[model samples]
Target: MTRPKSTSAHVQPTLAQLRALIAVVDAGGFGEAAAELNVSQSSLSEAVGKLEDLTGRPLLRRSARGTVPTPAGLRAVGHARSAVQAAGDVLLAAQDDSQLSGVLRVSSFRSGATYLLPPVLVAFRQQHPAVTVKLLDGDRAGAGEQLLRSGQADLALIEGVSAVDLSLTPLLMDDYLFIAPESRGTQPVTVQELAESPLLLSPRGDACFQRIETYLGRLGIDTSSATEFEQDSVTLGMVRHGLGITLMPRLALLPVPDGLVLLPLPEPLSRPLAVATLPWRARLPLIQAFTAALVASLGSASGQTTPLALPVWNQSPKLEPEARG
Candidate 1:
């Protein structure tokens, strides 16, 4: 008589099989689950079939409404989700703790990407040669929102005044300066003094535009006649050509362009610059590593005397005047 074959060998389900069951249960259909997993429907079905065979029970009840997890499948799917997440954590731990070896997606505004992130990225890359940093540029608010809410970015560099719910760490302060033609007088420019020139301001709805308006409003300067330009390059170009003077952040004036002079605004208004990330995301080893590297880079660049502590949202430490510049 032939001996009964052993069934123990087939009991263990593969990670892919577990993932397929979870995706089908979560997504409610084979096609939707396949799309979400970036695999073909047939392949997804095959994976779930293998999982069912391993357990010797049908994991999903297919119907016109959608695929629903059976009783055993319901319990198994719950465990599978946790298992998949655990597997991911293990992989991330291996990459982050042992050797950095994955893509780190960073989002920032144009100026931050250009002037601020280069040194930080360079230093991080030197330390974690296997990790690749992908930078995505957008407006400050947009980038911060994407990074914090949408989970599209691993980290973000954004202006400090963000409305979203996120964990923000102050990196530095960027001083707002007066940009004028070289022909303008050398003395520090007052709001009233600059108001006398043809003022090239950012468009009304812009954050920078609103900031300048508030600053000038306090000085009783009428800016109704200011020419508004949408792009920074255009505003700076106009200033370069003697069309008007404009208020610009020092970060935007790195390697100040030819034919332009940067003078300190009276009383020197500055905006705080911060790194933003989700609170949960901050706990990840990769994000923590990147944040440390970034802080070190910024600290080195700014020449801070003491060790830096991460600041809470809207609460930034005062840096020395030279550091702000």
Candidate 2:
């Protein structure tokens, strides 16, 4: 008599399968997820399909709005993220605890990426040449935190991080300033001037721009006529042309562009820039190493010791003195 074939009762999922599921869910479609993962659409679909087969459940819902996680997928996605993060930690654990090596993925907003991270990255590279650092976009408000929660990034340089789950390391207090064409001169901007100026605004989702709008609105200033620019440099360029004035963080206005002047705001305003990471991952050798490099770079840049805590916000810190004249 022929014995009946038996199938295994257990189901197992590979990191690739879990990652494929996550990408599809996050991107809301196979095509976009495939592009993000740098894989063929068909292959990505296949990976998701296999994951579904193993779990015996359909994991995505396709609709006019786009692909989204099914009920089961919604339940599973969080676990999948945790699993992937664990896999990374395993690699981290395997490394010589004294020496750091592996990919360190970081996300940051435009200003931090441009002015803040470069020196830190340079210092980090010099110390740990074996580690590859990847910078991802965190341009929108809360984008950095979202990337961290989704396990897409190891660290995020963010402004005023409010997420309770992540651990924060305060880096700097970046003051907001009134920026104007040189023709406007070295005078501090008055509230009336700020309220009446044709404002060159950053794009809608920018954190700094949103804060400026909120602060102005509280003072009864109307922002409806502001012209939005996609790039900070472009907005500054327009300001230089005498098209409009803007309120910007000092970091974004660095090097005191030759044609513009930085003026103190009528009222003090600042944002706290910090490095964020999952609480558990905060002490990972790689992250700790990066933190040391970051602190060292900040000290070197400021020509002063990097403070352990961020300074109080809205302290009316002196504007760049050289830009006054």
| Per-model TM-score on C-alpha atoms | 0.66, 0.85
lDDT on C-alpha atoms for all candidate structures: 0.74, 0.82
How badly does each model clash, as a count of residue pairs? Answer: 0, 0
Q: lDDT: which candidate is best?
A: 2
Model 2 accuracy (lDDT, Cα): 0.82
Cα error, residue 192 of model 2, in Å, equals 1.3
Q: On residues 196-287, what C-alpha lDDT tens digit does candidate 2 reach at each position?
A: 88999998777877999999998889888899999888998999999999989877876567777776788889888888999998878898
Off by over 4 Å in 1: 1-90, 93-98, 140-142, 161-164, 222-224, 306-325
lDDT, candidate 1, 1-325, per-residue tens: 1224337873677889988887888799999999998999999999988787777778899788799988888889767865665577566765545477777888887778888788888888888889899987656445555544544466888776554678877777777878788777566566567658888987786557777888888888878999998778888888888888898777776656677777778866777777888765666677788888777777775566422422112211111133243
Q: Candidate 1: what lDDT?
A: 0.74
